[model samples]
Target: MTATTTAANPDAPATAPRYEISVGGMTCAACAARVERRLNKLDGVSASVNYATERAQVSCGPDVDPRLLVEQVQRAGYQARRVDDVAGADGDDDSEQARRVTDLRRRLAVAAVLAVPLCDLSLALSLFPELRFPGWQWVCLVLAAPVVGWCALPFHRVALAGARHGRSSMDTLVSGGVLASSAWSLWVMVAGGTPAPGLGQGLSVVNGGGHALYLEVAAGVTTFVLAGRYFEARAKRSAGAAMRALLTLGAKDVEVVRADGTRRVPVTELLVGDVFLARPGEKIATDAVVVEGRSALDVSTLTGEPVPREVGVGDQAVGGAVNVGGWLRLRATRVGADTQLARMARLVRDAQQGKAAAQRLADRVAAVFVPAVLALAALTAAGWLLAGQPAGLALTATVAVLVVACPCALGLATPTAVLVGTGRGASLGVFIKGPAALEATRAVDTVVLDKTGTLTEGRMRLVDVRPASGQASAELLAMAGAVEAASEHPIAAAITAEAGAVPAVTEFEALPGLGARGLVDGRAVVVGREPLLAELGMAVPDELRAGRGELERAGATVVLVGWDGHARGLLAVADTVRTTSAAAVAALRGLGLHPMLVTGDNAGTAAAVAAEVGIDDVVAETLPADKVDVVRRLQRDGHRVAVVGDGVNDAAALAAADLGMAIGAGTDAAIEAADIVLAREDLLVVPDAVELARRTHRTIRGNLWWAFGYNVAALPLAMTGLLSPLVAGAAMSLSSVFVVSHSLRLRAFRPNR
Candidate 1:
């Protein structure tokens, strides 16, 4: 997460060092924002805090030790430590999330066990007077004690932490409500008076007036809040499970080749420049270029393409991809953190740890919400006291208002949705960078797709073949395929693939800068470009001239097939338009987004590909550097453009677009610059990601509405004495639960193919 830039001052030896730290006990977006605010207040420091991942990305000057960043976060009211400093025992189950889950379950079990019985007894006492007996209050208090005191430890501790930092959070509300109810019960037991076995049996007042104890309120609040926290933790873990699974895809070990001998070692032990051999079924150890052997790699693990990609000498292979066919000897170009797989994992992690604009606003509201609620509670108490209500009733109303006004819901609204949305998208092979990328998708009106790799297969394929007026089609392909079998070019491969089982030529001669000459069954066959056809003294036949011209106009590379020194027929080769690309373009149109083809190919090629894929606007003849200017021009024209591409040449354009979606198989530069990554080669993910963003934002808006609406409606009722303290406690705890539960619904999101 750290990137060092040279200091602007020429004389300065160094600049600020950036550090990322993980802070424990951040229950809401407000807590993360508060930590970020405190860290940024320090001299020469700036920070971005993400609650979904519970990590802070911080930058500070060299003069300030990185350790101080942790201290600052601690000052902002949470437990803190540097990410690199905290090393748990190495095991899959030893992750921070696993530990949190274990801890939450334990606390929730204890609270629920005690709370249930206590609530039952309190409710039983209210409804069935015969169940009341001597020492019943004592028994209820005994049961509620541990539930509020021990089982509720986390909330109390966090609330105190917020107090020290002069900020209040969800914990503050929960702790205040629990402590007030518990203290009121204890105070009633000590001072209010003792009741006989049959006392209050026939009393119509269930309120208990000033003498009522709320042992159930204290216990129930603890149990419900802890239960909510447990489920919230589990949902968060589920949301990030895909990313964790991705981290495990890289090879664990590889055979490192040496001058003396090859030695098997852990991938961590291997370094750049080391050569390694990958077996037929083994995963590629790192990002490397093949030095020997040919194989079809199942790179779908990285690119989400269903087809196996052929890789041979000098072709680069990504780590985590399995070599499905033949063995490959590769020279390690990138190892450890430098590998593509590692970079992608890092991107997902870093993207998860970013703050969205909506979350920032929610945090600001929460920072002020708790204090305002407390003030409102105090005003309500004074107003009631002035109106001649008893002190106990006033205190009850105050507690109700304090408990009902939930900042937790507001704080949980955005981060939880982001967590589930990004996680679900990752599962779908749509790597949404973060909330900002999601936000960009919702606004973008035009999508620009690159031709070579985006809308097309990026590989040559034989599209058509024509034989002279009366000649057999099979005979023409037989001779052409025989000549092409001697070549290693992509065009040759496409022709050979479509040639079927053709008879081998007797003698094949290679033609440089042209086609080849061969002999099939004692007949002279010339296969090459038009120049080679002319060199063979082959005259263009009148009947096939129009057909050849049509193929050439459609962006195909046409080769002249000649035999016996005369033109025979024409064969066309072009980059295959992906079978799914037309549907993807149509889907974008249905979404009311204009799809344009932006390619550096010749106008004929670009227009032909565009027509095939239903793209009306073709921006052809674009220079690599000028791609950015194209995106900028679209922006100036009031189009919110999202440009999709797959190479280093597209990096600038990706960065310049309103939203940049890079292909997963693209160069590192493009992926790094992109706001979103199409991890799957399917063009459909473009519209899928956009539709997913719209859905996620819609969910966020809905959650915020419920959160704000609940508080707005409930707070007044609580103040006006329409809602009781017991009801208020239940409402407060459930509000947070509702927000988190709503966020979990996104985990069920399944995008259309």
Candidate 2:
């Protein structure tokens, strides 16, 4: 016997451990439950199957043989691989299998067409007596059989296979009940029994015992189960569409330039070191570096920023970005699965595979639920038989228990809510990584914000210019602009913009980190930071320092300009605050979370931005590596933290935090690392995501309670022979309807904030 273990429950002992197993070869819902049942049969195994992606995760005891478990799955005609190293590769086989499963939609459509008429026939016989034709009824039943069987053969096949192995599932319960009902009805018809009066019959046959054929009941149950399955496939397809769309973003081909000549080739065929020529208005086909020429690339597809970024030789260009102007020759640096887009797509795929904590609990309850119901039904029949009840009454009570105690409602609860919530979040420009991330967002207590690009507009602009030594402001600006024009730094743009007009300079020289120098109007001019001016033997006055302090307090980067090697004036430039930052910060605080600011900018600028956004705690002048350290420190202090950032530098911190949120308008590195990606740069979506996750969590819990309550309360009533088969069928259908309708409420969610 193989050892198995259940997932650690929240109320379980603290010493209990949790485990995850990777499942494979699941092609549909039936396959999901099939693997789930086989693994669950082990003493302590508890598992959930995510059909959208073919993976089953199970948790169990420490003594279980991981190898034996894998062999059990393989014996059941599917692969089972342990997730020993969570490489996050989105393994090649899963993607291919996911694509194959998408075709199940065709199967669902066929099932739906067969179900409609079967339901109509069933309803007509029950509601109107005049419509019954004694001879024609058997003909209708025969006709409906093929349609129902053909449409429902998938479930029958899986259920029969499970039964052969002494295992049972939701399919086994449903398939067994419907088959028994259909066979009994056929036997009565063939044996020449008295006909059941149609609806509105004058005779009351209730008190007197009479045999009646119920072909419609058998056909209807099969049709209804098929209908449910069709919709389930459709829902899985809809949710998995995002991963497919992400895969479609890359271009199919690129214009490759080889020694022989330039020719177009498939992107997959392009190898590293292959040079590609991208002309104005052409899309970059793969991740590459500019080897020649210059161009302004519109990376809006990846970053969501509108401004076209200028790139020259040696700059890295990402795939899917459009080259807006100027021709460029790029050497392919990364291709195929190695591209950034591919990596991001892989991340999204992996996230979908890992079930949330709530979902895992639901699976645990469902695992033993069907078998327990089956045992109760058997006991009910034996009890009534021993009490000398008629065989008809005893058998009817047993079948009713089997039919009504189904766990369909329990199975649909969490996945349905998750589907609706994730769809709603995506529409609102919130890209949730997976169900676990969606659930975790509700518990976030600290929101760590990156000062640059997140709280502020990432683009720097000139705010003020002050002249020194009694010189005219414009004169200082003109000299500064002439020298600064030779530099490519962001601060240089502000200086040149303020300098309205200046003569063309000669003898231009750049001082790397310090600044630039050039001869303007036959006079040498220098523009840079204060330290650079002092290094050039220029005097630093107290007035200049005072102006620098004021600007720095306002989150501005101060630059100094000089003429003839003498200090001239100071210029202040800073990235402005976003209009939505304050409202977003306030909303987070309303949710009982303290917002903190973390940035690579200096202390003065970080403090200014934090104050503006109502963030109380600030960590400034922090390097990329230090950001992750800070998040760990906060976590060590027992904070459930979520980090929000928008730069490549923030990737480490984003991956380190409890929940990582990447502002959509940033580098691919940040988006790939973070668990949640805000599709719109608006900060309000952060709080909106949290609220949505919380609502989803509530719906799941409510649905779980409803599902559990129904099975617990109604199963006994059914076993006691108080419920008839007709009543049991109606109750079972209603439970499913209630679960679905409850899950649908998440679609209308609108955050109060």
Candidate 3:
């Protein structure tokens, strides 16, 4: 048995462990792109930054220092620290995140409260003409002051930080818009006198000099932008909630047993090889093997299967499983980073760091977008001022340009869709590795499915039974089943299941990996494969071999049952094909995706299973490593391929495929390598994921076009002075709202077929 070991990765760094950094102060997708670019520029370092998660996963070489990562992030005007250290070092964890949300809510409330009265007063004075008061400008000024300066503090702070780092973001555009609009409004209030106001003037007050007072514009923009951020923060938090829940599932404390006495210790203090007592309804402290008792363990938290796994002495039990049966004593075999739960968390982190092709383009464009918009706004103002336009008119156009061109939509176009899509996938039992997983799935023209544990239940069972003509099948099975019952091998258990009750057998003997030899009811009986039959001196009749040739060709593990040294019957054992495998294959084909079987099993076995599952393409008798080569060959043929498997041996192939989908019930290594993990072990989810990906990919593109189209049409209108700052501000807010709303459509997704 090639027992899977996961702690020591063949691809691990020699001296430095990978660090997942909790990045602070990223305001947009462009900010994440910049941080990733800066970190990657360092020698012997690679980084993937996700703005939605506010996390950076970094890999460093022995030649480089890990501290350099923190320093580089700091220089880029963001904070970074190891994920495990971030929450405790600053005395902030979930509370810090909650506090940020609270801050946005409070600021939004303040801006809303102050802006409402200011707008109401301005409207009343403009329409009635008799509501004028002494220094009403001062009252308007006082109300607009904190709404712009204090309520919009987050924008100004991030904008200034970006400026310090020689960059700009959506925040810069927003801050500039508010400042330009507010500054000009103050100028008119102090230098120009307000004549009587009238109706149908919108939010602007036109005085004797034709100068405009935009107190409402200043307050409204701040309120709208603040509302967008508050909702955006809430959505981002929702996308990451699953990972946080997974991290918290570990048992906080464990009961340790020793020669001195039984005592409880924190789970972190438990060591490898320690003996621990797990009573009924308690979670296993760490990965261990039951040594003294039997119980059924519920492994659903990790595998997503509700079935409880029965364990006896020497059966390995994984961490995070709840003991559902009687008390059991287990010896810890793996702990801390070695546990399966930690590995899944690490894989989730790594997957979140990757950027999809569309996302990369979006981020790169956003990096250049902010600066270009600033220049355009300046040029819009300069062109007006140079053309003999009044300063008030020029500034109005400039502020309008800035407000209209804010890339809130651009920054949100990809990540919002990705966040929503991935969250929906998790609920449907499909965990996507990252945005790229969906992109890859959209292009999957061929699906390479592993035989064992993927299309079949990776366990041997009785598949075919034949006896000599006129011989009683029950009588033949009775003698063979009795002799095999004394053995505990997979093939024996399968045969015994189909075999009816039989009298007791004596003189039982076992042959490892071959067959069995014994006496059943005082009659000599034997059961084994072809080689074993020959070894047992049993003469296989030519008629029997010829008649059974088709069964062997169809992938059954043919075994000869003999008595008195002559073949009497044949029994075939095989890994049973899943009931839904055929339907999944048909669905994939209907979707225009070619389904192929790739397996390490013998050609006969592979072909038989393929035929049963409605698959025509078959690659058989390949070694584990050769599986990767097969996937690469398919890719070289210009095929976008997805490999589905559920074992350690399939890990390499799964990773090498364009999209690697692991059955959630698979080994940890396989799950870690897969780009998509199916929590329910149902092959049908493969097609569901494919459909979901295609849908999400379409949604992202449509959103990008909407965002790009809105800015393209709005910027020119604002620059030409046809659009007011108030109108531009409303359009900008709506653009972001539209992107988020479109992305949310994915949340309602379900398996269509």
Best by TM-score: 1
Give the TM-scores of the predictions, in the order they appear: 0.80, 0.68, 0.79
Runs in model 1 lying further than 4 Å from the true structure: 1-16, 85-94, 164-167, 194-208, 292-301, 306-315, 323-326, 460-554, 557-573, 624-630
Report every candidate's CA lDDT: 0.77, 0.69, 0.76
User: How would you encode candidate 3's per-residue C-alpha lDDT over 99-172 as one tens digit per residue?
Assistant: 88899999999999998887788778777667788877778889989999999998999999888889888888
Q: How accurate is candidate 1 locally (lDDT)?
A: 0.77
Worst 10 residues of 1 by lDDT: 196-205
- State the local distance difference test value for candidate 2: 0.69
> TM-score: which is higher, 1 or 3?
1
Ranking of all candidate structures by their TM-score, best first? 1, 3, 2
Judging by lDDT, tell me the better candidate of 2 and 3: 3
What's the true lDDT of residue 140 in model 1?
Answer: 85
Clashing pairs in 3: none
